[model samples]
Target: MYIDSHVHTSFSGDSDTPPEKQIEQAISLGMPVLYITDHQDFDCPPGVPEFTFETEPYFRKLRELKEQFRDRIELRIGVELGLQTNIPTDLTAYASGHPFDFIIGSTHVCCGMDPYYPEFYENRPEEEAYRSYFEYELENIKAYDCFDVAGHLDYVVRYGPNKNTFYSYEKYKELFDEILKTLIAKGKGIECNTAGFKAGLNHPHPTEEILKRYRELGGEILTLGSDAHQTVHLAYHFSAIGDLLKSCGFRYYTVFKDRKPEFLPL
Candidate 1:
């Protein structure tokens, strides 16, 4: 009954695992549902030229996998779009034309810098980077209404030079509150990405404190994902997260179909 809502295949520049291999891995790992959300960041970095979207080929392979594994596991086709506040119109148009089961809007870039590179935070203080990252995320979430969920609410922490030593939602309460408020107002859910645990962080990307605050702020929709790049990582740590969500006052997890959310009791 586990559903891994975020995954990337070889189609994404960062991953080399093919579509079939992704499916085989899912099956071997006993995942009942998997969503292939390859990166569709149009503003490719200098060294990352192949990060563009290949919708046709990606969807074609997805259609094939859906039929081929219809009985064994549920295959959901999805896209993870890097949200830039400046190009909201283009992002909206591109996402509108697709028939994806789920869409995860992410903030991979901030102030023209990709934090994935160590140099992005070389001379900058962790606080400054975190502040800018939250600022960009707030703007992107407010600008784009096409996505179903916001991916990895605190993804910037993973690559920051200081790591998690200096970052926490409590330190950025004002910005964090605004982000949660905007998402609540827009009816967009925040994803609980367990990938942070895999990266050696003590908690998920957005800590349980943020999840509690999100729930307290009247935010209802919350989705879960491992942000798995490999098959063995699918639904990783979800059992613990399910309990965590309940303690945080969320009784349900969400799923999307035709861009609408369906709530499942936790």
Candidate 2:
């Protein structure tokens, strides 16, 4: 069955689409399994909006939905954590105790600021900004060490004024290699985020070059996600994604349940 491992619902601070609407769209699209990974950034950057949700209430709603849609589609609850410098131990404890099917560790805020803003790029060249983002990513992952996968390796480049114009895996090969190496050594995975294609970037979030490099580095346990914030984007660009992954030498993809990996043949 085709699975979209990264998704969001109304529970996420940025999304307003109802949770059931998201599931209905997936079922209409013939997707048998999907995950709802709401955002939870404990310590958001200054001026950036905080993304925090009550776990018990969120899960309670999801549990009700799971029962309501039991025969229509298999729904899983997960969280996308924006990894920062100071990760709360209680946050880890909450996840450890709660039932999360998957968790994505992402670097949305770097150097106490969000790259999505214009000020984040002020007085800093894209190269330095991108480098600092990756540096923060590496540091955060090394310290947090609790997530299941890296959200988007090259996400920083997505917001640049040039916007991948001068971007390539080779340009940042050294740091990219280290990042992939660290994830592999730590038994973590990554995702093929399809949001970039919709943003007119004409590539996945990490780009094809990085995905191929991850394969070259013996990195498996990859998953497919649209990073959708609404129903219209539930499984965006999946048709082309299959061919893309095959060309990159991926024979299979992955899904998670109860925080354990499950492989599915391509």
Candidate 3:
């Protein structure tokens, strides 16, 4: 099974699943690596749920569990950092101060509002909202250099009114190409998040076409994640990932340890 690089436990604001339950599920599934990348979005705007966690307790609990299950699995500590245009220093400070094995830089907030909330798409066309989201993402990555990989590059689409029913890579080719080029130039990576299937979409977070374009642009550091918040969701829909990656021209998938990438045969 592919390593689940984006997972959440009780420490996250949106999840209540205990960390041990997630660990036990990964072990039961025979997944060699379990990355506990809970949410850590700082300075959330009004009306958005607070996504921050206490670092000391989070680290203490995970470190204890990591040692306790050392022989059974390789449990890695990771954080899903919420990338914002205004908080580059906060992100850099948090990343530099921690010893996390992996960091999934995510754009959860866009233009002072969250796309998950209905108001973000209230007054504007869905296409405009999506464009604003992409613009926010581009500004973020260009402003900061603290993360290893970009998570859910097309996350805003999942909650759109149409939800990919009319979406295509060609619809926004220029912006998408720039995003891919910038990531490749920064030596960063992107992930194939399976949560899209759970969100009622036919494909992953980034459509298959985007994945192909990333590969065509010489982006090699691709990772796979469930973006799961519950035990049943751990490694969600991973059984088909190998074939999908092969079709995307990926010979291998990535795993991170100590902030370094290791490619494994697909």
CA lDDT, every prediction?
A: 0.85, 0.87, 0.93
Candidate 1 lDDT tens digits, 133-196: 8998999998889899999999989988778987778899999999999999988999989999
lDDT of 3 by residue, 1-266 (tens): 77999999999999999999999999999998899999999988988888999999999999999999999998999999999976534788889999999999999998898899888899889899999998888888887788999999999999999989888889989988999999999999999999999999989989999999999999999999999999999999999989998999999999999999999999
Top TM-score model: 3
Worst 10 residues of 3 by lDDT: 85-94
lDDT of 3: 0.93
The digit string of per-residue lDDT tens for model 2 on 166-210 reads: 888888889989999889999999999999997789999788988
**Clashing residue pairs, backbone N/CA/C < 3 A, model 3:** none
Q: Which prediction has the highest lDDT against the true structure?
A: 3
lDDT ranking, best first: 3, 2, 1
C-alpha lDDT of residue 4 in model 1: 73
Candidate 1 overall lDDT versus native: 0.85
Model 1 residue pairs with clashes: none
